[model samples]
Target: MNETQSYLTEVHCLECGHSMPYRPDLDFCEACNAAWLDARYDYSRAADLWRPGLPGRHVSLWRYRALLPPVPEEFRISMGEGNTPLIRATKLQASLGHPAIFIKDERQMPTNSFKDRQGSLAISVLKQRGVTECVLASTGNAAVAYAAYAACADIKLWVFLTSLVPPEKMREVALYGAEVVKVTGTYDEAKKIAANFARRRNLHLDRGAKAIAGKESMKTLAFEIAEQLARAQGNHTPWQAPDWYIQAVSGGIGPLGVLKGFTELYEMGLTDRIPKIGVIQTSGCAPMVRAMALDREQAEPVIPQSRIVVLSTGDPGLAYTLLYRAQKENGGAMLSVTDEEAFAAMRWLARTQGISVEPATAVAFAGLRKLVAGGTIRNEETVVVNCSGHTFPVEKHIMDDQMVLDMKLSQQAKSKEQGLTEALRRLEEQITSVLVIDDNPLDRLLVKRVLQSNKPYRVFEAGSGPEGLEVAETRAPDLIILDLNMPDMDGFTVLDRLKANPDTAAIPVVVVSAKELTPNEKSRLTGKIASIWQKGAFSANTLLQHLVKTIQTGTPSTAGSDVINALQTLDRSIHKIVIVDDTPADIRRLRRFLEARRKYQIFEANSGQEGLAVIKAQRPDLIILDLSMPDMDGLEVLDTIKLEPDLRRIPIIILSGEELSAEQWQRLDDETTDILPKEEITPETLASHVDRKLS
Candidate 1:
């Protein structure tokens, strides 16, 4: 193949088999809108892409550019993704009584997951095609991956994430500059809103299977595996194929890409045979596995019941039929593992191989273990397992404490404008203070430089553990960055003493050291430390990001604490009250009663919309809202107020004479809002409701 020429022929419908010349604008088949499009490459024009460990050849997924969608040098977007390590799982193989089990360690990917390949390819194509903005809905990793690549390409992106995804994952994408809109419903529901938003805004919508370039990116893993295997003997070694290829699926995109890759290898005379494929799913949302169990082409959409959000793609779409046919043709199997089993698999893999993978990836290993025990996978067969991605979400739990102002299920439509911006703004305003307790001057200076480089942090330093404790006790910084080796007093003693001391006990510590901890040391430090980083293993930027997170983990943030304090003193500190009513007479009456009850500063709005504007701008302590209003009604205003994180926290008293219907009562009661009858409203009746709500 020519260096710059792409052999990519066309994109075709998997169901209808209708093909069209590849176009960046087209996502679905023209003939069959329901079925997703799959990319086709004219393999006769293709040549060998494997030049492993060779100088001047790219080390990333872009190494196989001849087979991938072509992009100009200027438009190419990459973070050196792919080229992940494949380790022989010697311990796992022995335990399973299998001859060979190799982990295609996608944990080594740049974004710490295989989805980086998709991001790299998809963003490169989008940039090459001059597409400026795009939208995606992902349970977790994919959103982060795509956002990172899009950041590199300088493309605007909005990501819709499933609500169940750990808060850390949402924060990760936001860090990558993606506008994050979280769905309070299922993963599929988020997809609907995201796709609609993309169309409404006239931007690219990247959906699984339909995202042709992203789907095509998965095949590069097959290429790398082949190249790696060939290089093991010699770079010139003829193609050798594994007996089995297995992976966990969300939308079943990974295996579909692998199937296409291996088939192409066979057609191109690189591989002698295609491997039998195995796809795994979490039992909580295993539509394809369920369908495969009954020999059905597809299964009904499942409501995701899994706590493992990343693996919960409830409906597999065109992926079912395409993967099903491929599996059947290749003598493969589809299986599901429970969350418990996946968690156990995560522990097992880490215990045996020292590989900590996310629960989504563990689902495959769990299924692999089950398959081998059931004799579905023979002991003599060589199996390759795709450890697709995740360690980031599993390790971090800091997003909860951060200023993550998430929108509710009913608030998604309104979120497109205000939600993500609010979240990012709040994060920027959050300040964390750090104290460094390292005896090494260079290391202490390094840390101080990194922290100070970021912004607004009050960085304190101590040369020894005792001095550090003294400073920590007096200053009570938000977090401490400590080093293990110190003169006169060691870090462990400092940790014990700090935990024992009441004043400094709650301060989180991040240990940065050159020393490698043993099992006993690791166990000792497990609950004591927020995180550990080896001195040279991390960059200054990475250390800064993690240090900030360490300050936030496990405790309510500084901002959250301030909010709590503010809420506690509302009755005494807050003086502003907004009376939202259409009638000037009613507003005057309510204001007079409120002012007499307490020394409150009264604000007035003539209409519901006007009231919302005033309430938002003034951020009143309480709201006295009239139900009956012209134009925007009280219900609409209530919805808008409750949808906003800042506005929702304020106390609302519905002082209206209007007889509310049963449904309106339900909605109001659900919000737990206080209601006072306008007809019965006197100084005493209104005061009781206002006092109770404010108090």
Candidate 2:
């Protein structure tokens, strides 16, 4: 490498602080057993070389060549990834009662997302290393970006993705000539599969945040924001960081990289302060938000339920070690928004500001609204929200539902007879039809009640799989809620038959089952089923809310809209409860008792680790723990829970088989809601204690 190319001095492990030579294949630090690595630069020399008025005609990220990973100019791959517009959101600011609000419109970047910045740098670096093939796992946008950039660099790319990814995204990725593997599980699972594939093939794996080049490119966003803000203020300062920098995160690499950029500016005396960063996530699958709320250093993995596909990273690799510390040190806060709030914000932006964004991007705006309303953000502070990407081919999934609702409401408001007739015709043509296929009458009735409570839809019932198939063929319903435990035919057989027929294959199917699906059953439903709802894991209102959104968005796999309205209309409140015990009998007893009331959304875990993960993911209102487990006893779990400020507030009841001594009782008393003997735990007494504590 030449002198300028040698700007990258070394790569270091963020966890163990061990440094090593920069290599394309070295992803993890062996010394520390850490997956995250940071690229160190000769910043002293970089500061001297980079000045306010450096001569450069290029406006792309390469403008700061001294700071980015070194690559020969001839080998660099650039598609105008940086220097995107920074628009002042005057209307949004006025509406939110904030003084200054600006939008860093990353949607303007090539490939229509911030991923382009990383892709451009990453692909260029790989090319320099003479790497011919690479693989990665992405929800959507990143795949498209990498496919495009890698193709430009004449490199072979393999992409692994979950089946939940939108059809449009898959088409886009395939169109770029990249080999795609559609995994039959969540994004986290897809990542694992991709890692295994890379290992077996000995191919270069694009390790997202764990790769130095991947995160290094994202710092340009921060650099651009500072420079643009300074220019907007008519100031000649080299940098001007915002009072607050907000962005929605999945892996959290973007925000961490941006923070690093600001830190670089501060070291160079170009900026005075590091902006207080704000991270946003969907409430449905927000491990980072949960960790933040609990005041924990690490975020536990979750099975993500968010419909915002790009933000559904169940495990944010390196976030706890890198991004969490950045947030804490910078005096930042994390916030979460529901699908309803994000959709509302999406609609508001489109109507008022004429900015159409995907749900993931709108999440940041929703967070901004929440912060303003909660007084977490002052009115006078200058804030910048990252408008990361726009919704296009996926636009139908984001806007069509609201459009349909708006059209119906508009037609109803018209006074003309022609308009009324037209509205009636539209309703008749577009009315959603649902089919409930279950052997149990109670289950069918429950499905009907939930679907009907939200909006008017024609509901059809089938007592068996054969009858359900016949009705499905005849009625051509928009959706089907299938139960696995049928008398004559199981749900898997029904699903397979439906998929075999071209006529019925297009319709979406939601699996609602009480029985735990076997591996074979799960495999059969992988890409076939749109969603799976455990029978007692959700309340009727929650089901209704989800169904409405799924119908509206035309994405059966996505989470539903806000349930605040549904909650208001429901007769009884439903609270989530998690039971942690090694005994299956104990778990079944609690579940049986809780299910009888139909007021608790219950989850179960056999080990303390599993229980902790579930608690972090679900944020249950109450926890029931068995004190004497084989590994990681209840007391240890209780101590871990109590350490988290947010989780400590959740009431926990301990059920111990052994009688505790005076000191043990006192120690337990200080942290737990109550400790009752397992032998004394009757259904009635347990129910009473639960009701009182929850109340």
Candidate 3:
């Protein structure tokens, strides 16, 4: 086969099957109205083109040249990408009791990502056509890959990136001689800017997945994984497909190509079966997962909420439709893991398997664990997870202390200088709304002063957990600098409530406790907050530095919050119980009984009106309500709460002084609501009923 030769046939839309002859200028589906167009190959000549002289080749992605996108020999530049190791995760498999688990460590690729494959083909083809200038936008990895290849191809390239991207990533692109323009907006905004730049310069635009080279080059991963698995069994045995093939997704180009590769191989008598394609996503930006869960054919855009900025592609565009259909047909799961889980998995992989993966890769590992635990992936089945790249180190030295130029999108701002100043003023107004949740007056005042002295922060104080939650919603602060030792409600419980509420989950949190955290407390805080300071032990400067980092990066504080805020604070994995009654004796009795029986975090409201307020604030797992109240009746409270879509899911337990009401019984849910007579109820009876309802 010729080195630059390929069996390339056409470019077609994955959505509308709109086809055209292979053209370098082709990007979207054009008249077809889709965001992705993939390369098609003449499969009749596939065996001769793909299966020739396998024993001795370049040992890089170009080894299978005829199977890749075509470019002239002189333009086919490569830094020895591909040939990444597929290691058996023995410890991980054993820990989870799985038969076979493999990690396709794509971190070994030239630019330390699977993206190198895309760049090798994409940039080569562009270089062959004498393209001198290009532009693209990326969260991180793709920008680095494209920049490196463009540099090698001697093509000038410009990369637009979101401010949430790590400095390390920006520096990586800059080191490859690409002009890096950091935008203070979402990834989608960055793409628009890059597109505008490309149009103005008449430059080639490669918006990552929008290029056919991605589909063509990424298929090589599927090919290599098949070949490697067979060779590992020793005697050049037949390539066998694993039961599950998994990858962490952003724009979702990798899986599209991978699924294409396996399908072609199976048709061409290479592999026996197609693997179930699994795409993992961060919970903060899981449009695909959300769509699949609702059985939707297309994905809806989500606000980029997670701190893992690298995997922060909120809109997958038409790629979601393609992936969704493939997943539905192939019998796979699209799952999302929390930022906390992803970081924890990153740590786990490093400690147990000696694998240092970025939080994006960690999302895949976490999803694999979730699948295994959920029985979606059986232990007896084989699994292969793509460890896409090295973790985001977030080192300051990489950029030499140079922050990105904060791109302003406001139409009112004219000049760059005025725009930046206005942006900073607006950001200051938002970030300075720091909420200090501490019981100690002196400590709260000290923290308020420390924060204000540095940035003139407008601080709000809350002496208890409930007060803090109320203030958190009302003030809507950018960061919560809190102490853990509150007497009214422990700061931990407050942390749980803050996280559980969608209104506050995206807010960054920092711990500034006078008391040193215990092992249990440390474990709880590890992936939740950016860092915990021993209040007076650390210098104010150090605290501010950590605060700035923890508070998230973007145009405004709301663009997304700090990396340590990547910790995303605490999750409400524990159940909360709320007691509502006008009678103090009944409220105290029930609270005491539940507190002694189980360690459920209990909150109380003296009347029905106060109870409704408590439920809205707390979002408790279970509610104990007294039917008769002076302010509002229990049934009315139930009706009001049930009307709210967000609060309707919470279970309620009603305590009535007397019973014999069929109409009231008809209004309540059998599964979520249970009634009991106060005169007849006992601790044991209440415990049994509560346990059953909770179960």
Q: Judging by TM-score against the true structure, name the best candidate.
A: 1
- Best candidate (score: lDDT): 2
Give the TM-score comparing model 2 with the true structure, all chains together: 0.56
lDDT against the true structure, each candidate: 0.76, 0.78, 0.77
Encode model 1's per-residue lDDT on 628-688: one tens digit a residue. 8997888888999989998888888886687888998988884447888889999998888
Model 1 spans > 4 angstroms off: 32-35, 47-58, 233-236, 389-405, 410-695
Sorted on TM-score, best first, the list reads 1, 3, 2
lDDT (Cα, 0-100) at 181 in candidate 1:
72
Candidate scoring better on TM-score of 2 and 3: 3
| TM-score, every prediction | 0.59, 0.56, 0.58
lDDT string, candidate 2, 8-42, tens digits: 78889987899988775567896876878898888
lDDT of 3 at 561: 17
**Weakest lDDT window of 10 consecutive positions for candidate 3:** 554-563
